[model samples]
Target: MSEKSRFEYVREGAKTRDGVDIVYYEPNLPPGSKAERRMVRLVAFMLLLSGLAALIFVAAYIWWPFTDFPATDGWEYKPGNSFMKGYTPILGLSLGLALFLIGFAVLIWGKKLMPHEIALQDRHDGGSDPEERKLTGNTLAFIGEEFGLGRRPLLKVALLAPAAGLGAAALAVPVGMLIKDPHNPDELFRTGWSPEANGGKMVRMMREDMTPIRPEDVSIGGQITAFPMTADGLGATNKYADSPVLLIRLRPKDAEFLRSQLHHHPVNVGGMYGDLVAYSKICTHAGCPASLYEQQTNLLLCPCHQSQFKITENARPVFGPASRRLPMLPIELDGEGYLVARNDFNGVPVGPAFWEKPAA
Candidate 1:
């Protein structure tokens, strides 16, 4: 049997040598009719709408109004905190509409103006023949020789230099980021809790508004989350995210139970209130702000993953994945009888165990 000719097989049902079938069509129109001209106008209109959408996309990219608060200083805009919080949504809508309009316009254009047809062809299997493979290989080899890179060492070096320089440029950006050490042992680890910062002065615990907390302010079965009071006696900045303490005023009986259980570092300071103790609010497992406190059960629940820490006895992890006990922030009273953070966490790392903190 003879092989089929590689040339054009048919005018209407043409199939290429690669076996890809192509079906051609020409739209029929009425003689000098204005209605046919209207169809052409409709096609142009769809295309024009697409062009307008493209222009709007570019304009939105250039000057769509948006506001971003500075990370260093920010308003405490929590959810449902204030109005005019639709800044994020507006930017999303404008960019989304711009893209959607462009796509819709193009789809409408194709449906209105273009003719559709179907064709079938037999699939070709396996690689090219030996002659074709050799031709391709020789073509590449000839091109390489034409460049004279094999003879001219200078040209070879020149071409290689740019590629090496580009690779180094790519590596330099990531290296620059890692060059500055984030784990500055002196600054990052230490806070105002250090005795040196306070000049032998004990640090007082303050509220979010810099109000000095008193034992009377917190109810006997309630808990108030507190931060380390700075030297200037102000609310702590973002630096003290790990320094949040849960000031819990337990019942007299429960306080006695804790003090007896913890013999070395007793919970009672001056034996006045008899049961107020402070522990780090951050979960040791994942560093989540463990704020969901249960007044009735004395079980502090982590809202994130339900890691329960008992508030009565040293904030010990009783249930869930959390392993380490919450760090106790040693507290004392100021001259005015307000609760204060005496020192930092008692050598206990606040967060998850990494390579730095080896397992015991």
Candidate 2:
């Protein structure tokens, strides 16, 4: 353990040079040995596996059957669209595998291929002279030399390939999010209720069974969950999850109160058909179904967090964590007397208040 018996990699073994201790130093594999080549190849294979999994993740995240396209009738969850269920799980598994392989590759590289050394350096009272600085720089260079990248070319390429790929993926995530343009009147701001989604015709409010609803269908003070009727029923699918609406037949007194408060809730202007007022089923707090309607109280309650929206005041949040009102779906009777959206919600598509706020 004396300085004279120091490892062959060093020239002069100054025991206390620069006020540091080389307590331990050993390589897991000798530099440029045949056995070292084999270990590098093994680590390279693991890195390759990690890169392959990462590529799979990127492909599945972008091009997989993730979207419930209208042409495919995405609502049925049948043979045609069942593959969509696997999309999320694939994303999870591939990303997870990619990360796991990278981690394992790093572990094996350190334990089986890289040098094993320990050094201790005491704190300095002042900046070092030129000699100390040169030694410090050489120390870093020595660590890199221990990896033998110059002597062995394969290790360099193996490290660079996966490192570049993983770097790009990491950059794409946060950068991609920061660069998205949220201002929009279509997909982001509008929903299935928008006339644009229904070929310029009003989207009829249909029941779960696909039957159009008339004014008489929802009883007085009663409410019903309704989806929009489109040619492919795209309105009914999770593609437009925020589109499900609560068509509540407000009591005469409540309807009168709503009309009187229209000045404050201007989004509800011409938003009702007689006494029937509709609001988004998705809660403004956390996107839970604000479905539990308390008839006597005229309160729409989100059972998830006990948030309450007073129906008589345009479904404005009066309790719990919700600070914003539910988006109102404007409704009127079509020529067939079935309820239909007069237009899309007056503001952004319904969800948590923090969602998209369109510039237009």
Candidate 3:
């Protein structure tokens, strides 16, 4: 069919705000039909549901009980374990529902309310004519000559100054982050067991209940989860996830073997106080708790990814994906006979390596 015949049914409508001509094609069905009204109501209902979900998402984000609660304490929201337990799921569900409803509504509106029509525009084969190109170039050159940028160096510099300053300001934001140390970098390498935390006094190794752990507390071929006795009493809390350590007491022969192979380990052999040694419970692979300890094999296993650390070999990664050895907290008997940290885990940073982490 000819192009003129193809558009014969199209009616010219009012011009748009931009002066573009509006064209209407004949609808397959008459307007204001019961089916069309039902579709309109369905689309409107979906859009309204989407708006309600979006509003709920914002409200939940602002007013949801996200306050941190101690493991021992209870909150009004009944945020079992931590206040963030239910926070993330609710936010995700509301936002996801809003987005899904919006997208589905748009799809339904297009399929049901809007008509499918084909439109065509005339195609050009080549660039503008030589005369048009020359005229355009002359116009631009005339504008440039009138501006007198070449004659006015100071004006040009003044114009460029703001752009240069803006570019510099944009560049400075990220560069400033690199130079600024908001918190101490040493904090990443040190744990709550740092000797300096307790007025230069040795920080005692304590259980989750805040009771000091004696050498007799951890039996041979057994492991006990321990935390540093901090001044603020942040033991076993989410605030101190990096502070948990597995205090494994090796058999005498196993301890002797580990002592003999101390040269292979990253930290000094003194990190072990007799047969009892404490290693960071955080897995080096992905920061999961390496809590699943096997007494017979003397391996601390991370349930998340199966990363195993040899308890009798300075907690070295003997199996799974872990590349670095578990950081060993230096321990010794305090004056009162309870186990205490001589110092923080050597100089190495704990957990997974990140972009800002220094090279080993």
TM-score of each: 0.47, 0.64, 0.53
Per-residue CA lDDT of candidate 1, range 113-145, in tens?
A: 333435565755887678655654554454344
In candidate 1, the residue pairs with backbone N, CA or C atoms under 3 Å apart (3 or more residues apart, or in different chains) clash, namely 205-340
Estimate, for each residue in 1-360, the C-alpha lDDT of model 3 and write its tens digit: 655531232222112111223244444334557776676566666666666666665555544442353322212345445555776687678768877876786687567555554444344577756764665465445434432334224434433433343344335333433333324456446677886666677798898899999999988888889988887787567656787888888899988888887877646567888888788888988999888988778888999989888877777788899888888888899889999988888876788853354332
Model 1, TM vs. native = 0.47
When sorted by lDDT, best at the front, the candidate numbers are: 2, 3, 1
For model 2, the run of ten residues with the poorest summed lDDT: 176-185
Model 1 spans with C-alpha error above 4 angstroms: 1-189, 196-200, 232-234, 264-273, 353-360
lDDT of 3 at 77: 49
Per residue, candidate 2 scores C-alpha lDDT tens digits across 85-174 of: 777688788778878888998898778877776777788687988987787677667667656566557767777756765666665443
CA lDDT, every model vs. true structure: 0.57, 0.75, 0.67
Taking the candidates one at a time, how many backbone clashes does each contain?
Answer: 1, 0, 0
Candidate 1 vs 3: which has more TM-score: 3
